[model samples]
Target: MPTGKLEWGRILGRLSPYTIQKGFRYLKHFGFKEFWIRLHERFEPEEIPYGPWYEEYRPDPEELEKQRKRKWKNPPKISIAVPAYQTPEKFLRQMMDSVLEQTYENWELCIVNASPKDASMEYILREYSRKDERIRWKKLEENKGIAENTNEALAMTTGDYVGLLDHDDLLAPNALYEVASALEREPDTEVIYTDEDKVRGEELEHFQPHLKPDFSPDLLRSNNYICHFFVVKKSILEKTGGFRRDYDGAQDYDFIFRCTEKAEKICHIPEILYHWRTHESSTADNPESKLYAFEAGKRAIEDNLKRSGLTGTVTQTKDYGFYRVKYPVIGTPLVSIIIPNKDAREDLEKCITSILGRSIYSNYEILIVENNSTSQEIFDYYRQLSENPKIRLLRWKKEFNYSAINNYAASKAKGEYLLFLNNDTEVITSDWIEEMLGFCQREDTGVVGAKLYYGNNTIQHAGTVIGIGGIAGHMFVDMPRERSGYMHKASIIQDLSAVTAACMMMKRQVFEAVQGFEETLSVAFNDVDLCLRVRELGYLVVYDPYVELYHYESKSRGAEDNKEKIRRFQTEIEFMRCRWEKLLKEGDPYYNKNLSLAKWNYSLRPKD
Candidate 1:
């Protein structure tokens, strides 16, 4: 066994023994609040006078040297901004001491005071400022609220980047050093955020890993996963004009979205670097705060909608974050649903019926391309369906080429949008049209697809995991419903690098812009190729589980047995190598590198 795997095995070996027993005990004792807090403070340097309690323990000299060597670089100047309201005096002093003791020397501290009644806060700030020139203090006559106070502190930040720290939150000793190193590595990054743990009183309770590294707008749109203590470029912050006072309760989320829009790049530091205090009064402790958050979030979404020039109305749904959008019918954006088939006329009929019956939006035409069907029944079925005004039948006459057939259909399409629907899939949602159309209608979105599942209720296609088993393929093949795992188990809507062509929708303009699919590669991996090209053109591809469908793989066509499956798989591998060389070089935009996928292990074929 290799050393790395061997070491991992050994650790895991020991873990399994205590994990069950100790895990339950730990959960009962500390809870998520304490666990989250302790994980972050675990690595924080303890030399600071005050701050979260770091148990008295010194790291081995060799390990300390390794840690120091990892951060060898020109550190960017980082300013820690602490907006103090009515926080305890001890907590304020502790926060100051934590900053002063950071291993990364190039940092300044800005304390914006919003407490007029407490002279102790001012006294502590004055004493800290007097002790360290890097510490700066500003006092308000009255409480300006946390959001406003944060804005006030924003003006005092002169460093390359600004780090948000609540008066009560504590930073690990290497927090600044880790961020500085990450920024140094990704110089173009405008925002650098880290995973954080929550603290309750003083015990470690839970760990929330923010391991997602890719910069995805859709991910942010869905939830504020990149929140908690984050370092953002000062220039970008200044440009966005700090937090919007209008979004008082959710100002941080608003500011983050606007800042992300202006930022060209972002980096996620995988380590837990900040300790978030989780008291009963804190937002983490209260669910009622969701109302304000929702309103602010809605405002942010409205702004994005207007900016994108999409005509839609948002309405609240019973589900907390769930919403319904009614898109007004402007001039009909003609849509063509392209389907490829060989045999299985019954399956095709069902597929077509679902679209015609369930679609809330009208103004779409279906194009069924017959791929050399050797069945007389299939020929008669098309003849019977020719009377349907919205359905068009095209005969491929030659061999079955999934890519070529779609490209041929697209060339004949009169619609402004192209939808690829597989004959084997049955649409289950009434809002499928609106769900996909909303994304396809957006100028920034290129391709949109629906979630697919087997007849057994297990997932069939949520998204594709590139570089899986020396071949990039679909993930969550047949997993039972459980915790929302990586393949969008919990999310109804998400941004994916590629969706199954089994049921995909795209704007005709984007399809034409990328010249549709590469006809050389037939059925497999063509969706990934199309999506990659679309993304390269600066458009996002989204996968929405809201429009659910049952996909009986290759049911419309005769299923190739083992020998043909291998042959087709080999062909797909070669095609993927030729078309997706860039993705292989920089890595798939969606696949998490730390994950155990088969595709990440190989060097893609050399680009021509």
Candidate 2:
């Protein structure tokens, strides 16, 4: 139960007088039910929790001392940039003090006081600057936009790297130390970001941490997940031209996208180093207050796409800042739909019927491998389905092996792309193939999986996480569909470590390149193993919620009922552990280590 920023966050603001006021605001905007549900979910305890986890994980006095004395051949100084505009005296003092208390010494605080008329602001800035020679400030003639104000601050930096800091936010004492340490490991790193949590009210109680994954391009295209504690090598900052006033509201988003586009090595420190202060007017507190920012974010993603020689239509989703990018089908390339079936006539019938009847992307073929089905009706149905020119049936006379069966069919596949679908599923989205194909068509993407729901409209598989339930399990399992489900994760497009093969789409070459699925993995974890290998080859495994489907997998099909079945399942588990030992032990890079691995929900890490 560690922290929740399921997009960048879900349960964002901590409970406080201000938070309660915001709750009433939500009640007015969303009516009573949605607000009530949100409040109720906050108390629904999960396997891991955040508050205790942070305290346990946070570096103590001894660790801080070690960091202070840590040797370096040539330590890099990080310049802290702050653009102050009528900032409250309380907030200004806390922000300055946070920098002064840094365990890492060789850093400077660069501030641009845009509020020149506010004499008290000048006095506080003068006092702090006098106290520490490292602290410096410049007063502007008049308040320029945020972008220009930041540029003034950026102009003052002489450090090797420049980090963005809001005037009212706090920084962990080890924040600079962590940045310097990561830079040591990756000396060539251009862009570095750290995980962040929200601090609210007079107490500044940290809540709803945004524990981020490793640098994900697709996830950044969705939302500014690299929002806080972001530092860029000085060269990249100069190259990206700092920031633009055109994207004033979301200047950081625009700047981040540009910096990442040019960055050779982007490093992420999973520890929560940044504290985002949430107030009524702050973007961290209220999304609607900054529609202009979200709109600017859309433009940012669009520009990034254009710069990469890729084209996509970007649109903001219902979730305030989260977006959706529709990548165009490159050239209507052929897709081969590969489905492995056994003696399940009804399931096979529905599956085949849905794809043939619903899929709008018509340039495709279906490779249905009949894997030793005992039923006569299944054979009859296969015969009927084969009548369609696009549908081809191949017989797998050998005993049931999910990997082998798919491999046999894949060998016979003619199309460029391979979509492995399960018989227990029905297509929900009309353009599901095109949706999956959009991401699959990307050169860097190796596999794409669909969002699956049970017949009851609860989520079955949004994505797959390694080290969950002792192997890998579908994330957001059985969560209600209507709810945004942790930072609108159920709706946004992002990269994942693995996805269920039930409805996975990938390039045929990628499948062949990875040597197809591991035949040794007979049934369980075969898909996960395939994805893990695909990822090993340095290709992205994407989870596209836009490609929706209903999976009728039996919920009651819990554990193997007999000893032989149980033994086979255990072997599969053992095989996954043995083969992908590093990923299992180190945890999924696409998933934050601070989050829970015990449950489907991205709960906080559990208490010891």
* Residue 223 in candidate 1, Cα distance off native in Å: 2.1
RMSD of each: 8.4, 3.4
The CA lDDT at 436 in model 1 is 83
lDDT of 2: 0.87
Q: Which parts of model 1 are misplaced by more than 4 Å?
A: 1-74, 88-101, 119-132, 186-188, 197-201, 307-311, 315-329, 468-470, 473-492, 556-560, 577-582, 598-608
Candidate maximizing TM-score = 2
lDDT of 2 by residue, 59-162 (tens): 88898888888778778999999999999999999999999888889899999999989999999999998999999999999999999999999999999999
Instruction: Encode model 1's per-residue lDDT on 395-437: one tens digit a residue.
Output: 8887888888999999999888888989988988877876788
Q: Once superposed on the true structure, which residue ranges of model 2 sit more than 4 Å away at CA?
A: 1-49, 554-559
lDDT of 2 at 286: 86
lDDT of 1 at 326: 43
